[model samples]
Target: MEIALVGAGAAAVGLLDALATTSLARVRPGLITVFEPSPHLWRGRPYGPDLDTVLVNAPPAIMSIRHGDPGHYAAWLGESGAAHLDDLLGQPLVPRHRYGDYLAATAEAALRTLRANGWRTRIARARVTGVERRGDRLAVVAADGGRYAADQVALCVGGGEPRDLYSLAAAPGYVHEPYPLARTLAPIPADARVAVLGSGLTAVDVVVSLAARGHTGPITMLSRSGLLPHVWQRPSGHRPAHVTAERVATAHREHGTVPLGHLIGLLRAELAEAGEDFDAFAADLLAAGTEDPVRRLRRQLRSVGDPRIGRRVLQETAHTVGPYAWRLLPESGRARLRRHFRLATSVASPMVPVNAATLLRLLDAGRLTLVPDVRAVEATGGGFAVTAGDSAIHVDAVVNAVNPPPQAVPRAAGELVASLVSGGLAAFHPAGGVVPADPRVQVAGDLAGGGPFITSGIPGIAAQAARTADAMLTLARDESSEAPATLR
Candidate 1:
């Protein structure tokens, strides 16, 4: 049997670790090749060493490389002596590069195991260009004119092209990409006025990175609502009164999908049960028209007393129902959720306290300007002029701090995803992702051109990895029994 995993991001790491250990001895694939476009395995853009202080959003325990060993990553940190950093804060968020190193080490361990079992394994440092089905086997083509035959192909390609606010392709000093911040912004003058175009997690990364690089000039973070993400407190062991798994299941059974109305009602019920008013809690978290919305939220949570419980209460509730809601909801329902996702994210996806604190420090020092209601950013002869509402500010440089571009898209999913869709091997679904691709070819992570329903957080991603491993094992076992003697 031959199994192929495409792309070497977090999803690829999870799949590779699982597939390496679970194959039955008889059914162990003769060859397992990983096609990774990046220079190294495991460290994708997010976890790559783009910035010095860009710490991981999740801690070690939750950011496990493999699903079965949930504590493996945290343990690896302790054994590697990297845990010393956590001494400052009892439970510390790891540096992004540290997580990348962990991934590389995990990949090394997995390769050793597969080699010991006499399973031929190789990492092809090239992007998979195409996947074409021929007879019972599949042909995996790489960009560098190499082809490998695999009984199964798993597309773990990450997201597609980024969602951009403006088309700055022709503008000088207009940077639409955010990674390799150390390199991208290296040419800017120290006192150059800079403008960043977003205010989410990625924006925090830009601000932190600039500060670390000793960029002393004023940096403006421009956005609508002008609200920074709230900071995360240590999570509490609290369960919701109304937004339980049982309730989600009930909603699915009764409504065919988790109705948007029912989901909202469940949230309101949870607030009422806790003697909290839903409107008040939301107002405090989504407090816009203020210079420091994030600080206001932190203060509000503290005022509630037992801040951890108060902060995590709504986040936990939304996450609990999210998977069910995404899978079961129709187009209209998903649309409804998307409309409020940013607001939901303000509470559901808070920045790590460290990043938030850094932002506050920068703000207090008057080094960072938070611009509200960004209308347009047009290229000027000298630089880019940003128009926010009726006001305008020209900056020498513009750094797009929006979400990173998706790794693949349907139309421009390069050769691999395009081949799969064009050859009828897969079909795209905004909510459902690619329709299972093929029964034999399991597509992990996001499959659609844009937003996918797959859970991307650590716990959910690890769980999905485990499931993919089991599926690979079952498929390998069945295929080995029927494969020709040459394949075996």
Candidate 2:
């Protein structure tokens, strides 16, 4: 059997590692080909040198690729003496580079194991341009005119490049898209005024890098919402004492299924019924509900209108439900959870303001500036012209921090749902971004309803890869079982 895996980022690595460790390595696919354009296969753009300050927001314990080994990553850190195991687990942040190294090491180990077993594994250092279905097999075409046939395929392509800066065709300033920060930050005049486009984690990393490099120039971080990420804080142990199946069932019965927005109402009802302080109850509930206390707190903030109420919910949930609260949602509940996210963004939480403190500190220190919004830009004088919101700011460099367009897989495995849909072999998902398949693991990661698969974080990407691998293995096994005796 020929198995093809697309992209060599964290997800791909996880899949490969899982395959290496499993019995499937011996009984299944004769050859495994991985399509990755980067020179460093396991370490993709996120872990590159340009993003030194990019930190993993998850605790090391929950960040490992190995299934059922919650403390694997933390143990790795402790054994390596990178830091004390307690310090590593106690803190809410881990350096992005360390995580990158861990992934690389894991991939290397898997590769060695595969080689030792005499299994054929190939890494194609070229871009995959298209995928086509050919009878019982699939054809993966490379941009450079090469092709590979696979009995199965896995599309694990990582995030696309950063979005363009603005609508202008050409501008004098540099519009950085996947631009190397080391190159951009080196040898700059200390008094230069730099404007960063987004206020998310990417913008934060850039701003923090600039400050660390002794750039005294005024930097402006502009965005649609102008909101930055909240600082990493150690979660305290506090939980809501109330949270029973009866309470949840009661809320669902009364509201006909509660959305996250109704969390406030549910809490209020519970409080009134129990005759207790809502804040105290919420604190205990959240603490008991979530393993990641900080994330639990964030979820509460996301559920309510009042900042105090949100904080209390998060604190209580963290103490009561543990980390499983977020994971315990059923598929229908998950869909509702996604909907609640869209609604929660409108109401400003007190915690939302905390997102900007780092940037604000830089502005106050005169190390960053808020540039006037640009209206238009035109090429002129052999350079480019830029219009701010109301003023014109001309510069030699500009970076586009906008989010990238969605990605599409040119080809998919012979039995993979995405491949079938792209090849007109299957139907598309109702939501449009997914290929129709088993709803649990077969996600669409393309613009047309497939998914980029993972989000913008390491933990998310790792989890997606693991889930995908499990699904693919299961599918392959079921197919093999139903095949002719000779084929099996």
Candidate 3:
């Protein structure tokens, strides 16, 4: 096929898996090129191997790279000499790097199998600087002046560059990149107060990392809603009694791309069927002040099951239709979703049990504070001045813990997309990033607008890769059929 898979991250892993197992190979010749300059294969920066207090919000149960093999990572943990920790495998969240270990191991094993099965695969230890159409093929040009010709290019560039919370590029004590190869936080004095922007899981990771490293000084996490992420409980696989895939399909058939509000109504109905409601949950999520809404939510989680059960049902429903739903929506519906998506997703991506426990412990000890949101950040004589809703605080360091905004445009990817779009091989989605003009050029990953399905996590990536590959294979079939017959 002479396929070029750019960006060997989780999305690439998904594509590799698809190529390795699917019958699509019957339609094309076999030669795959992977471009990644990272030291290791599949562990993208987020999953890079490192010893840190940061933990993946998802549990080991759902961490497998293989689509149908849910227990792949759990089994790998037992076989990879970490069997002693098997007791915690069922529900506890493990270190983030363990996922890197799983991914790298999975990639190595899969690549070996592919080679043994008579498939040729090559790795390019460089970055794909840009993609330009050269005659009949797309040229994946590397920064090292290397160019690879491909019948098709699958752009799996992961999430784009992070959006900075403040313009503190030159400000002292401002920790812009919280997750770094080396910890810049160790230099901060133990007694120095800090302000953390955003109260999502990213903020939780930063706070947990600081608290574990003996940073006893106060930390105030500021976010727009002042709501912390929901707590994870044991997962329930049973379909929510009310909100099922059939219901979503039915809603779509009736409403023609269900509005975000009506989808919320469906979710509320599911919760009600499950003997729960979103009244309290909504109150906490919509709360606009320094009060910790998650505190009340956590108490409820301890008493009842995780609030994410209803969310899981709705998320599963979204899996069936969300990718096209976003595009199908009226401008008003899109606006509503864009306005509240983060707040809604915060509850969907829950914090691990231990993270919630650690956060509450810090809060109880008065070392952590959750504020409404950061209004502004400015440089002060000592460090940075952060203004929350009503109070102003100056801290020794300001850590921006906000994750990339939804549908963020990749900083470096802009050039590549521009090249492709200018060449009429791709289209940029106004909601977010680039979309492939033809199935020959595929875009897969967290920046989901370019493909048929949108997703960020491992499962979504795997499915998106498979879908993109299948679509590409279909296009390849057409291309092959149309090629002129020749005798050489």
Model 3: weakest 10-residue lDDT segment is: 81-90
**Candidate 1 residue runs with Cα over 4 Å from true position:** 21-28, 79-90, 237-255, 261-310, 313-321, 404-412, 430-433, 448-455, 480-488
Model 2 residue runs over 4 Å out of place are: 21-29, 79-95, 113-118, 235-360, 370-396, 405-422, 425-456
Clashes of 2: 61
Q: Please identify model 3 stretches exceeding 4 Å from their true place.
A: 79-90, 240-256, 259-291, 304-308, 315-321, 450-455, 481-488
Sequence-dependent TM-score of model 1: 0.86
lDDT of 1 at 329: 63
Question: How does model 2 score by TM-score?
Answer: 0.69
| Global Cα lDDT for candidate 1 | 0.70
Which residue pairs show collisions in model 3? 1-29
Candidate 2 C-alpha lDDT tens digits along 53-125:
4555444544676654556666766655344222412443445666777778888888788767766888898
User: Which has the better lDDT: candidate 1, or candidate 2?
Assistant: 1
Q: In angstroms, how far off is 430's CA in candidate 3? A: 0.6
Instruction: Please give the RMSD of candidate 1 to the true structure.
Output: 3.7
